[model samples]
Target: MTAEKTDTLIVGGGQAGIAMSEHLTDMGIPHLVLERNRIAERWRSERWDSLVANGPAWHDRFPGLEFDDVAPETFPPKERMAQYFEDYAKMIKAPVRTNVEVKSVQRCAGRPGFIAKTSQGEIEAQRVVAATGPFQVPAFPNIVPEESSITQIHSSNYKNPDQLAEGAVLVVGGGASGSQIAEELMRAGRKVYLSIGEHYRPPRSYRDRDYVWWLGVLGKWDEIKTQAKKKHVAFAVSGYDGGKTIDFRNMGHQGVTVLGITQSYKDGVLSFANDLAENIKEGDIAYLDVLREADAYVERNGIDLPPEPEAWDIQPDPSCVTDPILELDLKEAQVGTIIWATGFKFDFSWLDVDAFDDKGMPFHKRGISAETGVYFLGLPELTNRASSFIYGSWYDAKYIATHIGVQRNYVAYQKEK
Candidate 1:
């Protein structure tokens, strides 16, 4: 209700924010964590109805927090993850105020702090940390027109197969969201048109254990220490056809029509690039590359793991090449729904600061912003490939929080001297 002053201002109450809050609290610093909606708002609303946490619960927990009383191996659904965040916030007594949206975060012109204008009121703080996370704005490509007549759904708004039209669905993008949605639609007995690009079909499990288990043991995630390798990380396996594997190795046999990347849509005709076959080939290459890395890790560490199962053949189906859709008439194809699983973009327009780059991207080394009192967390490739991931976010938060606390306390101590 009133303008409150704090030592630090946290702009989100998600995992990163709460993690940092715990650190700041232990450091005996006054801070406030603000969320526009409920904590874990994206997990609560933006996700599809049937969507589950892409990773297992055991590996997803943050520092000082674990999924207690819950099955560690279970892949939790959207609501469950949301509740986990809510419960975690309560468990730690994080100073989170939900429904308070930050409108702008501006540096105090001649001062050593920031002023955050919010829907609730203006708050002043010596340090401001943005933990808003990635996946904020839905990215729709220019290829898709805005005035199209048929129904279009961004992957964020999608819930389940029942929400789609009674006609065929054309899913654009072949990454995790696209592949998962296409498989879901197909399982519901709907004709699915999948637009393919470079994708990886990493097996969910390898050699009697979850693939992530091997990653943990081999320190794969930690090996990704630079931004150069972050872009190459493959998406999670969609347990569609194979209950435990990706099964994209047999995409052509999955009863879904594969197409090239959507290039343009005009006059009821959608044009696609002639790169469908090439993309599929690239996917095979990615799969092999990833498999080799895993195998090499196991061998180098003298990990005498059991050999890959005899029944689990990762060999690509010979029928990968079928009729690729170069272009299609919307009316003739009878496709009525267009789903855009094109990924996300970030909008930091509200953070009125010159520390941002020409493209409005915040300039930060790790999580510390270019401006001394400002910081950013929960960004992809911030420090490592996992910087944006829940498991990796806490590390960034901890470092940033520690820096802010030492700097704030030192500044205060200087005044006393």
Candidate 2:
């Protein structure tokens, strides 16, 4: 097979990969983006029809472009966002090799580069950026049974409410995805039961002011530094009110019962943890009270801070009822569909580097991995508020590109012999 060469190779041409490509182009770096499908294919294929971004329009832009003029200050629909990414790739002229599936990535033996084996051919690059985001793999809870008569599907596979069975639908997980799906199912006249878990919920509008307004005030958009501070901030602000949070409450208003955590599904019967929602909501509120106190302290101290704000103070309604675990005989209850909206996990089996920890994510400091030329973007708390989000990857990309440039210059001079 023919072997191509470049200064850098970026895997996964989604939001993070696109951002890295833009930064590399701006720096005049010769890099190649290898994607298994067309750009932003995940967003195009996975998200639902009524889906819109959780963040405001102003916060949705990538490196050079802004989403301000296209949609109003509100959240843009998923289709519009996908189109925006396509436009971004066109505007930057990002050299992306579509339909090239990367099979494996290994360090080039005794060379200052990496060798990527793909379905098409081999590529040699001095550096590789794993821009694949967290949603690479769907995370299903162990509580789900192996043998159940009811059909089970993850949120990724779920397209619309029509796909679910006619009887009662149990949405396992109270996160944004689970809650939104439950809402849609309830709206479609299905008897929906939502299995609530540890989740953060906030008002759609607080005191007639947009939630984004508070985000700006709290500096949720700022960059982060230091591991201790990063941990504190990540744990505190991990779940900002994505549009799904508010939709969950609306579903309750529409007569959807929020149940406890799902325990197991066996012999056609679904069991759940008793009083799970009460425990989870209590825990969530107690945690938020602490964060609120901390925020008050920060304001009282008059500290000038960065743009990213803490995520802890968002609260859920305390009056919501928690359904007891269903001990119903499978034949009697007639539950038909089970939608797992648990969450996502990272898969890095293709990366043949020692930089990854036991969790499969590369051990990195500000996007620079332990491996010499390998880097990462879109990791949680990488630079700040933007690290995990599509809008934040650009900042990380700019920094990583600058570092790569310096390293390339040093290597060129060393090879002058």
- Candidate maximizing TM-score: 1
RMSD list, candidates in order: 2.5, 5.0
**Which lDDT tens digits does candidate 1 get at residues 300-362?**
888777877443344554343455667788878888899998888888877887678777888
Question: By lDDT, who's the top model here?
Answer: 1
Over 37-119, each residue of candidate 2 has an lDDT whose tens digit, in order, gives 88888778886676677666766676478874555456777787888888889898999888999999999888679899999
Misplaced by over 4 Å in model 2 are 207-209, 221-250, 275-280, 283-323, 326-330, 414-417
How high is the CA lDDT of each candidate model?
0.78, 0.72
Task: State model 1's lDDT.
Answer: 0.78
> Clash number for every model?
0, 11
